[model samples]
Target: TLVKTKGKLSFQEPKTKGSIRTIKVPDLAIQTLKAHKLKQKEIKLAASSAYKDHDLVVANWTGSMIDPADINADFKIACKFANVPQIRFHDLRHTHATLLLQLGENPKVVSERLGHADVSITLNTYSHVLPTMQEDLAQNFNVAMQNIKKKSL
Candidate 1:
């Protein structure tokens, strides 16, 4: 995580141990990141001595950290160009969690992916999705029982 203290920027540990985790990325995302890395490499070659080389996945053309405000501004422009509704970048995290829960993904897995301190936090945060999951479970149970009855017959 990045911390801004008294007019200085620095990297810091996550707030909780749980927050330090590896996440699975989709193949498409991996490919995109690889392409971005190649582009960054070219930029580094061009910048030579001028490049700061903080080794960030995302950085300025000169390989320095991009300010958060600059990121937000770019995000706003991207949203506009994409014809998407304006939303804070952080909202993407909530959307990802909610979508997974709604799709009936295991709460524990989702919690781990989100680096939540506990599964209960994922359950509580996504309680609104549970009712649909329960309905699906009941339907699946009924189907299983029907199949068993047919096999017995």
Candidate 2:
């Protein structure tokens, strides 16, 4: 579902304007996905005629789309097992954006990575993460001032 449509909410493909994006994944994620695909293939063979294949990277035992409730329940169980604070699945997006901003990535790049409508939206959502950038700017200004003083001497 498009979260911010001025007209009407529609159940369409996610390839809307400015929403479609490609992101690079690390080797660890690639390895995990490959392992998951192999496991899914095994499951498909075991289920045989009962299986309903959706070609999903994340799906039910029979390869159908998983229900939201099931996801929430499983997430909670996993969090408890890992001894981590419970967070909603949606929170992962926020975490990703925050980490990128904190790591000094350009806001526009982060915005595009997140598939936001524009950089302004990304700035509005993550401006708090720019305090580190401000500190870096201050240090750079001090270095420039010191260089000018040495040149004058």
Candidate 3:
């Protein structure tokens, strides 16, 4: 995590032990990141001695850490260009969690991916998604019973 201390920005350890986690990235996202890394390598070569490699996934043209404010500004512009509602970049985390829950992903897995200290926190925060999941569960159960009956016959 990035933190500002005395007007200087620096990386810091996560607030909780649970925050240290390995998240499973989708194949498409992995591909995109690989492409970005290749592009970054090209940029690094172009920059030559001027490039400062902090090994960041996202950085400025000269390989310096991009300010969070700049990222938010760019995000806002992109949202405007895409004709989407403006939302804080941090809100994307919540959206990710909510979408996963709605898709019937196991809450424990979701909580781990989210780096939540406890699964209960994930459940409480996304309780609104549970109703839809409950309906899906009922439909799935009925299908399973029908399949079992068909097999027995």
Candidate number achieving the greatest lDDT relative to the actual structure = 3
Candidate 3 on 39-144: residue-level lDDT in tens? 9999999999999999999799988877788888999999999999988788899999999988888999999999888899999999999998999999999999
**Model 2 C-alpha lDDT per residue in residues 1-153, reported as the tens digit of each score:** 322356443346676676666788779989999999999999999999888986778777877766555677898889899999898767778989999887778888999988988899999988888887799879989999999999999
Model 1 / residue 124 / CA error / Å: 1.2
lDDT of 3 at 21: 76
Q: Rank candidates by lDDT, best first.
A: 3, 1, 2
How large an RMSD does model 1 have? 2.0
Mark the regions of model 2 whose C-alpha exceeds 4 Å error after superposition.
1-11, 136-153
TM for every model, in the order presented, reads 0.85, 0.78, 0.87
Predicted candidate 1 versus true structure: per-residue lDDT over 1-153, tens digit per residue: 976788776888889988888999889999999999999999999999999999999799888777777788888889999999987777788889989987878899999999988999989988888898899899999999999999999
Model 1: what TM-score?
Answer: 0.85
Off by over 4 Å in 3: 145-153
**Which residue pairs show backbone clashes in model 3?**
none
lDDT for residue 125 in candidate 2, whole number 0-100: 87
The 10-residue segment with the lowest total lDDT in model 3: 1-10
Q: Is candidate 1 or candidate 2 better by TM-score?
A: 1
Each candidate's root-mean-square deviation in Å?
2.0, 4.9, 2.0
